[model samples]
Target: MHAPRATSNPFVGLHHADTPLLLPNAWDHASALAMAGQGFRAIGTTSLAVAAAVGLPDGASATRDETLRLALLLGSQQFLLSVDAENGFSEDPDEVAEFARQLAAVGAVGINLEDGMGAVDRHAAKIAAVKSAVPGLFVNARTDTYWLGEHDETETLSRLDVYQQAGADGVFVPGLASAREIGALVARLDVPLNILYSPVGPAVPHLADLGVSRISFGSFLYRRSLGAALEAVVEIREGRRPGGRAPTYEDIQSLGADPARHD
Candidate 1:
């Protein structure tokens, strides 16, 4: 984080359309900074990772305070920041609008708002209100149709159309592991299309060719880190070596670790 200055919100709007924005979702300040150090121009905050860290339910509107605090902590980092604000944490359009303003003040250039399989009009209105409140903030409206991808994929496109009409700068569809579906969605959407990276699916270059404008690594890193730490501790208790690459003390110092949420 650094002092506020007048600069273009580089991550805002459809700028990611050219080379594709590979956004890694950081749960805390250290992770955000680590990614920035790796030359990532933008980063996203994962609500699932943040909520789980604070023992709150993800996508349940239970982590509004925690989410805001995390934004305050990492908003001024070098990388452009976008937040995964689950359903705006409220159904009311006005309430969501006010939340958007707070996020903008905290220095987030973009936000990912999910529909949560809720009403089409309801999520669309939230997008509208947020754009009105924080016009500079890029709104990547997400639809869970293909995410949960239970039925036909065409239904996902229909949902995105509503979000586009409501003024989303981009759209995200997770759980769309199929190349055919991804290509079709990219061809149809007027705005940038973001797809979550799948380890078992197409690689990054392949995805880029399919016309994906952004690829987000959601809570994958956070969850994997947790799993590694737990495994290491168990191995140590049993007098066995750990199973992964452990960072040196110097690296930890570089990350500026505290007792909570060390990167």
Candidate 2:
């Protein structure tokens, strides 16, 4: 088999901009291509959507094959792509490194690995191994202290420090919405700080002002899309029109056509 072609690596530079990079997460090709058609330079995969589509649980190390397949399909596309490989799908650091290599080989420019508040040493070792295996792949190290109910600021900082030392290109802290805390984390990290965008939390401009380099809508879009579909069905059943403009059949079909001419 031929080696994976090198991607242009535009994601890292996106962090240094005056404004924070707004990364929308997609579940499949249609979502990804549609986002890219709208001129989004970078798109990330939502692991929850991927696992749900296949009747599996997210963050349970069950969607490794599905994740790899999605990466292979999206990584070779026109835009920069990142895969959300939750905890690298294995406890073994070497297995995680191998998974990173496979993702990189398929043209993925970045990978998001979450610790799920597990052993810090194991997660750090995985990060180090992935970096060693694929130096070019942007490893976004994620800690779930806030999401998993451990809101200890000291623990969060300690894990981030270990991951950064292990060669993470960026640090992601989901469930962190306070601007003061976000600013403090950004100030403490040498690498770019990725914050999960919360609708009720700080706005994009506010986050940019707080020195957040990257903002991600993790699974929020996917969940909202499903909710919208259900709402539309309810409206139709009640003999009422759905609220928002729906995409036409042709418009939906066009996403699979010549992506180069999408715009």
Candidate 3:
């Protein structure tokens, strides 16, 4: 088996770099290679995109096999890969750990597991199991209180504390847009804080200033790509020129060639 690349293992270290790590989440081999071409050393897979591609529902544990298949396909690539396995595809901690083991064996350096506002202990068990199964894998334990519309600061803090204590390399809070709230969480958390980047939320630099260790563009790029394609077809039908830069056929084909190195 090929050894996991040095670039892949230092994914957690990227979180501690001078600036917050800006992770561009990709949906497929082409999107991943395209982002790597643009100089993103570490790329994450978006679960929503993975599920949508297979006509399955996201966050419903309906795409475990598809998610793993994507990971296996991208694991050998040059960029550091982080797989967003929604809820680890099962409620059983052992099953989640087994899945994480597979991801790591294939070359993924990190795994993002979300709580989805489930029981804190169950999520913690999954996190701990993953840590024990693959100690080197960076488990990004995510709490969706904000994304789920709970917005309970007390509950958020409580859940994060348990996740971190259970051995999450970092904690991700999606849908957290307030600078004050973000800063407060940053101050309180011991591990790296990963914030999902929202278009209307604080910009990258502001997030860095807020002490965010990582910023993930989760599903935004995938959604935008679809939106852009729709806009292009509509424009063509309306007898107007498409606005954005679309790559030539050859340019796209090149994405499947030799993967670009971070160096």
lDDT of 3 by residue, 44-81 (tens): 99999999998999999999999889899899988899
Highest lDDT: give the candidate number. Answer: 3
lDDT of 2: 0.90
C-alpha TM-scores of all predictions: 0.91, 0.95, 0.95
Q: Give the range where candidate 3 is weakest over 10 consecutive residues by summed lDDT.
A: 1-10
Alpha carbon lDDT at 119, candidate 3: 94
lDDT of each: 0.84, 0.90, 0.91
Off by over 4 Å in 2: 1-8, 261-263
Better of 1 and 3 by lDDT: 3
Give the per-residue lDDT of model 1 (tens digit) for 1-263. Answer: 01212236677433445566789999988888777778888889999899999898898999999989989988876668899999999999999989989999998888889998989999999999998888778888998986655746778989999999998888889888889888888888888888898889899999988888889999988988899989999999999988778767787577765424543
> Sorted on TM-score, highest at the top, how do the candidates line up?
2, 3, 1
True lDDT of residue 116, candidate 3: 91
User: How much is the lDDT of residue 132 in candidate 2?
Assistant: 91
TM-score of 2: 0.95
User: What is the full ranking by lDDT, best candidate first?
Assistant: 3, 2, 1
TM-score attained by model 1: 0.91
TM-score of model number 3 = 0.95
Looking at candidate 2, what is the lDDT of residue 147? 94
Candidate 1: worst 10 consecutive residues by lDDT?
Answer: 1-10
